[model samples]
Every structure is written in structure tokens, then in C-alpha cells.
Target chain A: MNFDKELDARGMNCPLPILKTKKSLTDMVSGQVLKVISTDCGSVKDMQAFADQTGNTLVSQTEENGEYIFFMQKK
Target chain B: MKKMAIIATKGTLDMAYPPFILASTAAALGYEVQVFFTFYGLQLLRKDLSSVMISPLANPAMPMPVPMPVMVQMLPGMESMATMMMKQKLKKHGVASLQELRDLCLEAEVKFVACQMTVDLFEFDKSEFIDNIEYGGAATFLGFAGDTDICLFV
Candidate 1:
């Protein structure tokens, strides 16, 4: 999928991945997409919660070789 | 915007993680968040965190390398050892340190209010805490907490 930025949150635990995602989204303009790669299993739910609470769009989420990949668009 | 008020009442290293983590995340979610540090919880606002060690004796759920009886956990150096092990595990899991998490909360504009009564009761010097935080009594915090959508006492 097309993305304007990429955040590698692999190996980072709970709040770190969400925190970094929030910070990254802040730097982008509305409608821009961000690709986040995380290894923390909990991030699967966290990213969804973050997207729901923040009003960002989680365009797609997929898993491959234990890595959770997410595409989120700024609101 | 939604608002959140958290009363932090624990001081140990393990207990410290919840308030900061939740505050920062809530702030990031565009909520106006405030954490009120009272009693022993005020230790989290101190400039030096050397005293914020965890005690295994208080936490039976803590996983240990071996089965540790209550008597063993009560040893003089057990607290320090447990704290060190927890710190290592946190680092290995890429969890932010308490100091780092607190800083993130501050950067996210999560208000930190230290309980003035606790400071007086505990005889803690005001200068011992980090700058850029507010000192107030329960009423001062309630002024905000009373109307907030989320109120938590951790």
C-alpha cells in the first residue's frame, strides 16, 4: 500500500509503539498515510484503539513472519 | 476534548509505570490529562529516582528465576535485586524507563500536580521535585477532576 511515512516500532512494548505512532502522525498533514511495523503482539489491539480514539484511519493491518504491519491515514 | 484525571498513590518502581503510561497515552489521544501525585506517589516527581525500588515481598505475582519463599523475599537485599531484574526485563522488552515515560507525559502536555499536603506531611523539600509541575491540595485537583469524563485512582 502507498504511504507517506514509515514507523518501525518493532521490539518496542505497549505504550512505546502507540506513543511513537502518535508522534509520527502529528508530523504529517491530514490525508497522508503512515506505515507502521511492530513486533509487539499487543500492538495489534493498541493500534486499533489508538486509531479509534484519535480518529485516524487504519487503512489496513496485516501480519507476516510475526511482524504486525499497519497502514494508518491522518485524519 | 475529553478530559482525564488520575490520582497516583503508589511509589514503588512497578507501581510507577501505570500512571505515566496511561497519562501519556491519554494525552496523545487528544485528551486533556492530569496526574495528581499524593502520598508516596510524590516520589515519582523527584529529580532522583534512586529510591523508587520495587519490593518482591509485596508482589506475590512477580515471576522469579526460582521459587522464592516469603522468608527469602524478606531478605535485606531482595528489594534491590528484584528492582534490578525488573529494570532489565523492561529494557529487554523495549519498555520505556520510568524517567522516560514521565518525560513523555510532560512533553505531551499531561499536567502533573503534586499534592501539597503530602509534601508538608512527608517533609519533602519542594526543590526535590522536578521543575514545571504544579503543587496543589485536593480541592485544586478536584476543580478539574470533578468534571472530567474519566477519573482514576491508581
Candidate 2:
């Protein structure tokens, strides 16, 4: 399925990238996907916790060219 | 299902901004946000407001070249300078001040709570605070936070 949004939070510290991602997701409907890119090492855990807490589905996570990408579907 | 509660206990100006900013943003995102101020954090609720509070110079958590006490002493008029810089920066970026943010939160029907124990400890009258403030204890705030989708301690 086509992702509904992309959030590039590279170089941002913890909480900020996750906070921004949450803000972006607020406007999306259920089943819509969001693609997140971040450079913070803490983001892996932060995003995972965020998805679990918000009941959003984390579709996939991958790393490429030194950046981390997370695919999530809004719940 | 958007709801959040932010517990604010720091008195320093820099530290104070996080809770207000986060709470305001949450409200803007349609979350039913509540900010509970306790301990030294009550300084933000003072009616006879002075300049924005400044962070303690000697925090262990602060990255160091200079110690905090020395930093505070070295920078005469730095508190005002930092406050002014923050004001300008927020305005430039469309972020709001604590007062303005508090107003917006009220306008949006977000909850603002002051810890009753803190008010008593600091010898402040409830009348001395801005309007729309609710009074409560830890239990009260905890009850609200229990069902919240987000909870932050700042």
C-alpha cells in the first residue's frame, strides 16, 4: 500500500523526532501509512514504544545508507 | 483518544519552556492536555511575574566546559538576555510564550492544575495565580494521567 506521508527527522535528537512524527500522524486516518526517517540511535526504541502506545501498526523497519527508516500504519 | 498530562517541576526558565511547549502543541493537535505544576515549578504560576526563570548554572546534566555556578556568575544580565533571545526565537518561529501558550490552552479548554501542597509550601494564595487554574494533589493528577494516551515529566 502507498504510504500517506513521509517524515524525515534525521539529525534531530530524541523526543523531538518522535514528537513530530506523532504530530504528523494525528492528521492521518486509520490504515494510512507513514514513513519515518531518523538518525537518532534512541529513535528505534522510541518509535517502537510510540507505535505500541498509540496502537499504530509498525509495518517494517530497515536501514540503508546509514539512515533508519520506519514504516507505520496509523491506527 | 488523544489525551496527555505533563508534570512540570523545574523552576529554571529553560526547563520551564518544555512543558508549556509540549502541552501547547499537544492541545493544538486536538489532545485533551493537562499540565500539573508542582514543587519549584510553581514559580511559573506566580502572579507577580519577573523575568523568565533561568537554568541553574551548575547542573551535572549540562555539557561542560564551564561549571554552572561559574556560568551563572560570569554572565551578568544573562538571564534577561536569554529570556529576550527565547522570546524573539519563539516569535520568529511562531512558537508562543508560557503566558500566551497558557492562554491558548485555556482557549482550547486544556486543563491547568497547580499542586495544592506546592501553593501552601510556597505560601502563595490561589488568588495570586492566573485564572482557570485547578487545585489538586498528586493523587488528583495521577487519576487524570492514568487514562491519558501520553504522560510526560518535565
Candidate 3:
């Protein structure tokens, strides 16, 4: 299924990017995906912890040209 | 997917803890959190003033039940004590300082907005704040708040 949204959280800091992603995900339907692009290095760990804590699915993640991209499915 | 906005305006010793703690905890809990600093809250972004921003004896918001004058006498050094206590509590709980939190937000990609009106009012140049802070107006903040699920005036 097509992801519901793309969130560009690049250049933001820890909790703000995660917070924005969380905010985006809340409005998403179950099973829908959100693509989060961030420049923050800590988002990798933070989002992992977030997915674990919230029961959301971290579908995929990768780094390209210095940006961190993550795909998450709403629980 | 819950979105929350916290407006941080007070920068007193007692006032600082709640916003940071609540915002960080909210982020930890998987909720999206945004903090908008305005007025005295902007002091938090000031490296020099941040550490010195304390409640004076005249502050009505001090927790003492006594009159302001008496409270000052009754609680000499309380601001420093409170600061120490907050630092200890944060360390014990693994919470970061305002500066560290700012770094963590940068690392975590958290969004931070500083009110432009306050900046102008205080004659603060953008360089006075940490790098990467987005400058915005009330309309911008309201736009974000409008779309968010929760909003708080702290």
C-alpha cells in the first residue's frame, strides 16, 4: 500500500523530529505508512525506541547523501 | 499520532522544570511534541542567562505561602537549592539540561521554534540563539497549533 504521508524533519533536533513524526502518524490510518526524512543522527535510535514503545512498525530505514529516511506503519 | 504544542513563556527556576520534563516525557511516550519559546521563555535559549534565570523574592509564582517579603527571608538561597535539586533530579532520571535537550533535539530531529516577536522585543539577534532554531510569528505558531491535537500554555 502507498504510504499516507511524507514528513521532512531534516535539520531538526531529537525530540522535535520524533514529535513531528508522531504527530503525523497519529492522523494516519492503521497499516498506512509514513516516510520520515531527518538529518538528525539520533533519530535512528530515538525512532527505534519510539516504535518499540508505541507498537508502531518501523518498516524500513536507510541513509542516503547524509539524510536518514524511515518508513513507519501505523499500528 | 497525537500532536502536542507547549508554549513556554516563564523562565523562573520553578517554572522551567515542568515544560522540559513534560515535553521530553511526551516524546518518550511516542507523542509528537513541539515547544514554542516566547517572552521570558526565550531566556532558555540564552547560554549566559539560562543558568542565571531564577525566581526572585518578588515572584508571585514562588511556591511559598507567605508574603513575598517574608518568603524571601524564609527561603534565602532557595533558588540555588531549587536549581541543584532540579539538576540532580534530571540526572537521576536521565533527563538532559535545556542545552543538552536542545542538542538531543538536533540529534533526534525535533522541531524548535523561537518567537520572532519576542526576539525583536528583546533586541536579540538570531545569532544569540543556538543554531538551527526556526524563527516564526504567532500566525505561524497558530498554524502549527491548529493542526496539532493538543496545545498547552506553560
C-alpha DockQ of every model: 0.89, 0.07, 0.10
Across residues B28-89, which tens digit of lDDT does each residue of candidate 2 receive? 55579999999988877776556455533454564433445665645777556555655665
Give candidate 1 misplaced runs (Cα > 4 Å). none
**Model 1 per-residue lDDT tens digits across residues B21-136:** 99999998999999999999999999998889998896888889999999999999999899999999999989999999999999999999999999999999999999999999
lDDT of 1 at A20: 94
In the range A1-75, model 3's lDDT, one tens digit per residue, is 357899998767646677678778877899999999988888899888889888999999899999999999999
Q: How do the residues B1-154 of candidate 3 rate in per-residue lDDT, one tens digit apiece?
A: 7777889898765576567756665665656778898998887666554464455445555454344574454476876765676566555644445666555445444566899999999898777677777888888888888988778898
- Measured with DockQ on alpha carbons, how good is candidate 1? 0.89
Q: What residue pairs clash in candidate 1, if any at all?
A: none
Q: Write the per-residue lDDT of candidate 2 for residues A1-75, one digit (tens) a residue.
A: 368899998866544566677778878998999999987777788778777766788898888887889998988
Residue A73 miss distance in model 1 (angstroms): 0.5
> Better model by lDDT, 1 or 3?
1
Between prediction 2 and prediction 3, the one with superior DockQ is 3
Best by lDDT: 1
